[model samples]
Target: MNLCELLQATDGVLLQGDARVSVQGLCYDSRAVTPGSLFVCLPGLHTDGHHYAAQAVAAGAVGLVCERPILGLPAELPVVQVTHSRRALAQLAIRLYDAPARRMTMIGITGTKGKTTTAHLIASVLRAAGHKVGVIGTNGVCWPGYRQPLDHTTPESSDLQRLLRQMADAGCDACVMEVSSLGLKMDRVTGILYDIGVFTNLSPDHIGPGEHASFAEYRAWKSVLFRRCRVGIVNADDPQTEAILTQHTCRVVTYGIDHPADWRADADLTLLRQSDFLGVQFTVTGPDGQARSYRLPMPGRFSVYNALATLAAAQVLDLSVAAAQTGLQKAAVEGRVEPVPLQAPFTVVLDYAHNEAAAENLLTSLRAYHPNQLWVVFGCGGGRSRVRRFGMGEACARLADFCIVTEDNSRGEPLPQILADIRTGMQRGNPRTPFVEIPDRRQALYYALDHAGPGDIVAVIGKGHETTLQRGNETLPFCERDILQKYMKARSS
Candidate 1:
């Protein structure tokens, strides 16, 4: 592609140099600049990308896309100035990738919770329907033979476009991704039109400095997806659904258990627990009034909502109910009520319930299983709102039979302070609740497992699908599954 051709995709003004300069690639990070790469200077919170323009040029960046003028760069080097570099990056990426998102059926799921699970469910159904599907969400970007971890639930524009191109090239018929509020606000999904947009549910989350300014803003960002998509599939049971759809342009399709919707699950939902398998069975009546029973290998009423959302999407895509049944029965998301196989009589589950609402939902749902004792082992991440720590603590204390407080990503913050905040919330929630504080997460897990009684369900949460533990400035390799397997093996030996 040429600089002139790429500029046609954006309203960037060519400041200097030849517009005919060849652009082989595009990059936002200076450190990743290569020969013939077009470096896009994005303004960030910590540091301005404009400062690295010279470095990017030195590393063989053929042209520069920046928000401001550069003083000391080759006069002949191409420079395109844009009002918003982030949006420009997205535009350039789409052009460079030949708009791969348009080549496949794009389904985007958004909300405070259930986005990841719903995305995986939709992908599973698409796969069962004999379509090559690709999924991007909290777990990462994955298809049939490829899987990669991501730094954010929704990646930046350049990487996202590149990934979509890869998926399209690999013959994927559809692509489902988790769309984060921040990703929408940051214009990461710019220039990509979604075939179907899904709103699982919304709650107060990511509300703090450097995130959403307020809950209202967060909800507003979530609503933006409805405008960019052709068909909006939403949760009718959520009270905020109307508010989230304010100013929306797409036609709405809904699914829920409590309210009447295009897709409605029956009230007689069953919770199934047999040996190591935990699942839910429910019958849903769609818009056509045909009732069909579906079984998902995931428990809780929330899982039912996720299924409803999936079914609604499947119907919108004109897929068969048989495909939905096959997919739901086998679809499983990692770190989401994920069951660990153990020889012991007690059950151990790993979940990513790091917030108040999530913790409450998980513990309450597990209680229906009639565990002799429901235990939760969790910790709050550092450098985040103390409100989250307090809420999580309070929820666990109020819901669980026992609470084991431990360390989570204490990113440069003192572990003692985080633990103290949690203790305060625990005291407020239920002072009489038996609780113990273990600063070490691994030690906390061991303590819970070592003391587990027969028929007890222990939930180790907070660091769900993450493979690394962040402490201070160091990110250590940590896999909870590996640790649990090692402990089980050692105990058996």
Candidate 2:
């Protein structure tokens, strides 16, 4: 594309670039700069991209997209200055990628939790309805036969456009993605128009440095997705639903379990079982007066909401309810209350409940199975809020019959200190709750398993579906399910 055309998409001032220059590619990281590339200088939380402009130029970056005036680099280097480099990057990427999302039906799911599971449910429904679907979320950027791990729930805008272009090239009919508050706040999805925007639910999360400054700001950022989509499918049962929809420009469709909605799930037929697999079975009623029974292999009330939101989206797309039901019945999310098979007579589930709210929900869901004893092994991530440590501790102390506190990617924080903080919360919540301190997460699993009785429910929380443990600057391979399976085998033999 011509340099003028690209800069026009970003409303940027061409400080030095020739208007007729042909741009070959775009890059944010200086290390990825190639000949004739335009380097976008984003002001990140850790380091300023402006500092790397010199390196990008040295590596053959022909032009620069920046928020501030350039210095230190060659004065004659082509530069495009925008009010916000990140937003400009999104706009530039959309134009460069030929607006791939516009060519395909784009579904965006956002909230504090359930984004991944809900996205999976939507993809399943779409695929069952005979559409080739692409998914980008917490799990990864995935398509029919391809998947690559993602470092962010919503990737940077430039990468997001590139991914969408790849999906379009792969012949996908639709794309479903999880949009994070940080991504929305930073204008990562600023340019791509969404066909459907689904809001699962919201809670206090991602609040601190490098994230939202406050809950209000977080909520507002989440609402941004609604403005960018054609249809807004929201969880009507959520307390913040009204606030989120106050200024939404899209056509609204609501779904919920409590409040009356376009699509509502009735838990009257809901059944919780801890037999061979932990799961829930229920029925949903749509605005068309059609009711269908659905079973999700994944357990919990939250699963119902995820299913309902997905069904609602499917309904908006005019997909058959039968297809949605079939998709829901077969849907399974990894590390999301995932059942680990064992012949030890007790049930073991793996989940990624790292926060107080998620932990509380997970434990409460497990309690519905009426286990002989609900055992929980949980820990807080290192270098995060100490408040989260206390919160998770208090949640387990109040809900679980037995608690085993362990390590969870301590990063740079001392394991002992994190455990001590949890201890403080547990003491305040339930001083009499029997608990044990196990620093090694693998050993923590064994400790819980060794002490479990028949019909007991042991939940290994935090780091669900994660394959690595981060300590300081290094990340080592670590899978909770592998640890459990190996231990169970060794014990049986």
Candidate 3:
């Protein structure tokens, strides 16, 4: 592709210097620059990409996409200036990938929770209905008849475009991606015009100095999905759903469990496997259509919403009720409310609940099942808000019968200080819940497993499906699920 053509797809930004520069590749990082490559200058949280502009040029960056005004450069090197680098990067990447997102039917799910589970259910149903569906979310990227390890929930703009192109080339007709607040705010999904956008729900998250400055900004970023989409599917029951939907210029579809809605939940919602591990069975009703029942392999109220949205999304995608039911029955997410295999007559769960809201939800659900005791093991990220850390500890102290404070990715922060902040939160609570602090995550797991009774339930939180634990600059190899499984098996034997 020529530099002239790429700039045309962008906001008509002037393409200075040679318009005939045949771009061979694209890069956002200066280290990856190569001959005839289009180097994008993105302003990051800690690093300004503009400083590396000369380095990119020195490394043979023939084309430059920058937000700042271009000054000194080879008179022949093509430079395009845009108001925003991230958006421009997405547009350019899409063009470079030949607009693969436009070629395929794309679905995006956003909100603070249930996005991963909803995406999983949708991908499963699509595959069962004999459609090639590609999935990109917290559980990792996969397509029908394919599975691939993913490092980021929402990858870099270039990686996103590259992956979409790969899926399209592999004959995938549709793709479902988890749209994060950060991803939308940063322009990761900029060029991809979504066919369907689903909002699961929202809560206080990613709100701090480096992330969203406030709740308003966070909500604003989630709204971007609805705007970018042509058809919006939202959980109408959520308190903020109307706000998100109103911002949409596209068509809207709503799903709920309480009443006869566009995608409604029928009567007789039961918690399947409630006595042992949790699961749910519910009937879905579409307007002027026969209701279909689904049996989810997972539990909780959120799972109900996840399946409801899946049914509606599947209906829109031309799938039968039977197909959606079958898919929901077998769909399982990796780290979101996952059940770890254990031989003990107790329940052991692995989840990515690292905050007060998620932890409260998980522990409260378990309490409803009347477990002998609920043990929660969680820790705060080193560089995140201390308010959240304290809040999560308070929630756990108020809810869980037993609490084990453990290390969770204390990158560049002192372990003792982080634990102290969590203790400060717990101190303000009932002050009766016993908490044993173990900086070693593995040691914490051993203590929790060794102490819990047969009827007790243990929840290992923070680092759900992730395989690494960060301590300052070092990322120790760790998988909470895998570690729990090994300990459980050893304890049983």
lDDT of each: 0.92, 0.88, 0.84
Q: Each model's TM-score?
A: 0.99, 0.97, 0.95
**Rank list by lDDT:** 1, 2, 3
lDDT of 1 by residue, 1-493 (tens): 9999999989899999999999999998999998999999998878888999999999999999999898988999989999999999999999999999999999999998899899999999998899999999899999989999999999999999999999999999899999999999998999889999999998899998789999999999999999999999999999999999999999999999888899999888799986577889999999999888899999889989999999999999999989999989989899999998888788888899889999988898899899999999999999999999999989999999899999999999999999999998898888889999988888888898899988899999898888899988899998898888789889889
Model 3: colliding residue pairs? 412-472
lDDT of 2 by residue, 1-493 (tens): 8788887787799887476777888899999899999899999899999999999999998889899887776767788889989889999999999999987999999988889889988998888889999999888899977889898989998899999999999999899999999889888899878999999888899889988889999999999888899999999999998888878999999999888999898857465675458778887888888887888888878888898999889989999877987888888778888889787899999888889888998899888888999999988999888888999999999999999999999998988999999999999879899999989887888898799999999999998879999876789899888888899898999
- What is the overall TM-score of model 3 with all chains considered together? 0.95
Off by over 4 Å in 2: 272-275
Ordered by TM-score, highest first, the candidates read 1, 2, 3
Q: TM-score: which candidate is best? A: 1
**What total of clashing residue pairs does each candidate reach?**
0, 1, 1
Tens digits of per-residue lDDT for model 3, 1-493:
8988888778746557877789877799999898989999999889988989899999999878888776688877778888888888888888889989987889999988788888988988988898888999887888756777776678888889989999999999989999998898888888778889999988888898879999988998898888888888988788888777656888888898774479888655676553246787777778667766678877667778888888888878779877887888878788877887677777788888888888888787767667788899889999889888998889999999888998899989998999998898888765988889988899999998889886788888887878898988998999877787887777667
How much does each candidate deviate from the true structure in C-alpha RMSD? 1.0, 1.5, 2.1
- Supply the global lDDT for candidate 1: 0.92
